[model samples]
Target chain A: MTYLLLFLAFLRVGFFSFGGGLAALPLIEREIVDTYRWLSKPEFLELLALSQLTPGPIAINAATFTGFKVGGMLGAFVATGAFCLPSVLLTLLVVTFLSRFRENPYVAGFLRGLRPALLALLLRVALSVIQDGIHDWFGLLLSITGGALLFFGKIEEIPLLLLGGILGLLWYGWR
Target chain B: MPERHRHTFLLFLTFLKIGAFTWGGGYAMIPLIRRELVEKQKVLSEDAFLEALSIAQSLPGALAVNTASLVGLMIGGVTLQLAFVLATALPSFFSIVVLAFFFLRFRELPLIQAFFRGALAVVVSVIVLAVWQIGRKAAEDSVDLVLTVVLLGFLLVTGIHPLFVVLLGGGLGLFLRR
Candidate 1:
């Protein structure tokens, strides 16, 4: 029953999410926390963190996590399938038309407008991470330095993630 | 194998590799796809890759998934399209499940807690990086600059539903696109 419900819920997310995973932030939040009542606000934040740290698209990562929490492995598979199935079908149907109208002015305008909002929405998600991830003073410092490295140095991402995990091990393990 | 089977297998392998290895997600896949497919194998022409990327981004799904579908559309047909999309989605699906399994099971363990905490803190920084990169690209002009400020301010202050924000932005964009 919940499997079907999970599928139905993420189906909306799969279709409507524009821009990318971050673009889906508000929608995913509303679906999981506000509408379905599957996860609490705090639980959702943890999911977001996990989504960020894990590989893959952030939306898929979050959906899988939430589904696992709700209904275990089958739930994970169902939620992911439901979430992506619509977009796959929709893409097949629309690619022909989309290519034809790729540069339509209205579409361009629509994308232009969505851009800043997507960035702003990402900012909102970023804040949620700070809220929870900053467990102590050292954690804040680690976040600051990590931000510095990413923005200033432009280090490739895989290493940066590894560094963060290693830093965590050192910071928390010894202390 | 038949020509059709060969194309499908190629699409699957390529998209599977992209999905499994590409980090930073979405836009990050753009360069990798260009390098791996466009430059190396010549599976897709540069123009086709760009066209597909634009179409993918303009549509609703994740860029990586959408791009793979578009690529599949070009290389084979509907059947191969499904194959590509699934291949792209598969890696993330399995990995997160394993991570979630452990995360849920041993969340109470102090050692694991410490590691996740550190990793998550860095994840926060990654979010900020995403914000900067995306914002820098989008907010290229004064109007966009104003839109960024207005939108970011509204999101931070009013806490309006983002659906309304996206809709309002699109509605306003129709007139304001300059």
Candidate 2:
């Protein structure tokens, strides 16, 4: 039952989560935490933290982690596979069509209209991250400093990300 | 070189690099994509860059994957297009599978936890930087800024699903921007 639920839930996430993994969070939170009772709020939060820490999409990570907790290794496989399946199929279809209509003006115009909306969506997601991740003054300062360095200093991203982690350890460890 | 071959090779190389380094999902991929597509490939001009960014946002799947697919289609032929999508997605797929395979063992490592904490902080910073850059480019006027702020406020306050906001914003952009 849990495996089936995990597979179906994640399949929905895979299909409907149009923006990205971060955009998928509220929906996942609703399903996993609010609807399914698979994980509590704090556990969902931990899952998010873990997802952020690990590689891959957060939705996939959350699916795997929650599936494992609920069922086990099989759950993990089912969840991860279900989560990614839509993307694979959708991309294949899009590619197939694009191969033919690559020059169609209507397709181009639709994409043109879609662009601003995408920008708006990305901005919304970024703001949500700031809201959830930065919980205190130190965290806020870290975000600001990091943002400034990346924006104004034009520091390479790898180093900037590494610096944030180091600062997290120093600040959070001492506290 | 034939344009198709050039685009395909570029797509493969770009996504391979993104896959290798990007952790913590799509936001992390944004700057890298910007660096490569806009800065390196120069496939998209400033206006087109903005357009691609918009499309990637409104449409679905992973942002990195979506951006790669569109850019791939635009710059390269179908072969390059598929290569770019694969390149962007394959890294995350492998990484997650590995993590899942070693789930129990990996979960217990204190050092790993510490590393994650450090990396997460950095990821946040990287996201912030991305927002700042995107805002500078995307918000060209007061209307754009208002739309951004209103949407932000709506999300923060009402806890509405992002998809709805995105749809609403798209309608607003179409009606207002034009």
Candidate 3:
């Protein structure tokens, strides 16, 4: 039953989550926190923190962690597989015929329309992450400083991520 | 023996490299993929690269995986599509398995916890920057700005599901954009 629920929950995410991992957050929060009562709001927030820290898609990390928390290793596998299945299948279907219509103007136009929407979705994701993840003044400051450095200074991302992790440990540990 | 077969095999190998090395997923893989395919392979043109980016963003699943599959399919066909998907996903799958095996034992270590904390801070910064970049590119006109503002407002104020917002945005794009 746990495996089934895990699969179904992530299957829904895979099928309907149009804008990738961050875009999947609200739905994930709803299902996990509100509907299933699997995790508390704070717990979900913590999971979000963990997800970001991990080395994978935030959504995937969330699913894995949630699944592990709920039903252990098997749950994690089920959730991850279900989350990915829809895309794997859809890609297969789409790619089968995409070549033929690669040059179609209508296809081009449809895609052209998608770009702005994608951007909008990503921006929404950014704001949502800030709201849920940044809990304190320190967090806000860290986020701003990190964001500014990346945006203006064009600092490479890996080092910034490493620095943020180190700072989190030092600040939180001392406090 | 067909050229298509060779292309598919090549797609598999290339994506395998992407999946193997990419640490953070989705956005992290973007630059690496851009460098490899656009710069080194020269498989996709600039316009196609932008189109792929747009499509990948609008689709479900991991953006890196989705983008890789799209590019592979475009260049090498159905076989390549399967290969790319597998290639992009394999690393995460294996890594998660490894982490799960050890997480219970190590989840409580103070130093490890501290490292994760620091990493989380960096993640926050990375996300903010990504949002800013995407916003700059997406907000082209007054209509685009309005749509973005409205969407952001809805996300913050109302608890409407994101999927609905994305659908609505797509419809708005189709109807409103010239």
lDDT rank order: 1, 3, 2
Give candidate 3's error at residue A118 in angstroms.
Answer: 5.2
- Model 1: per-residue lDDT, tens digit, A83-164? 7786677678767555576478887888777776676676776776678678888878888888988888877555776677
Specify the highest-DockQ model's number.
1
True contacts kept of each: 0.61, 0.35, 0.45
Per-residue CA lDDT of model 3 for B82-143, tens digit only, reads 67767776666556656655754676678766655655555667776766666677677777
Candidate 3's displacement at residue A73, Å, is 4.0
TM-score of each model's B chain?
0.88, 0.59, 0.72
Give the better candidate number (1 or 3) by lDDT. 1
- By TM-score, the best candidate is 1
lDDT of 2 by residue, A1-175 (tens): 8788988888876665655766566567767876799887545644655565566556767777877777776877787667766665555565556444424555444433333444556665455556566666766776777677766777766566666667766666554
TM-score of each candidate? 0.89, 0.61, 0.76
| Model 2 spans > 4 angstroms off | A16-71, A95-128, A135-137, A153-163, A170-175, B1-58, B63-90, B97-122, B140-143, B171-178
**CAPRI band of model 2?**
acceptable
Candidates in descending DockQ order: 1, 3, 2
In model 1, which regions exceed 4 Å deviation?
A40-49, A173-175, B156-158
Best by lDDT: 1
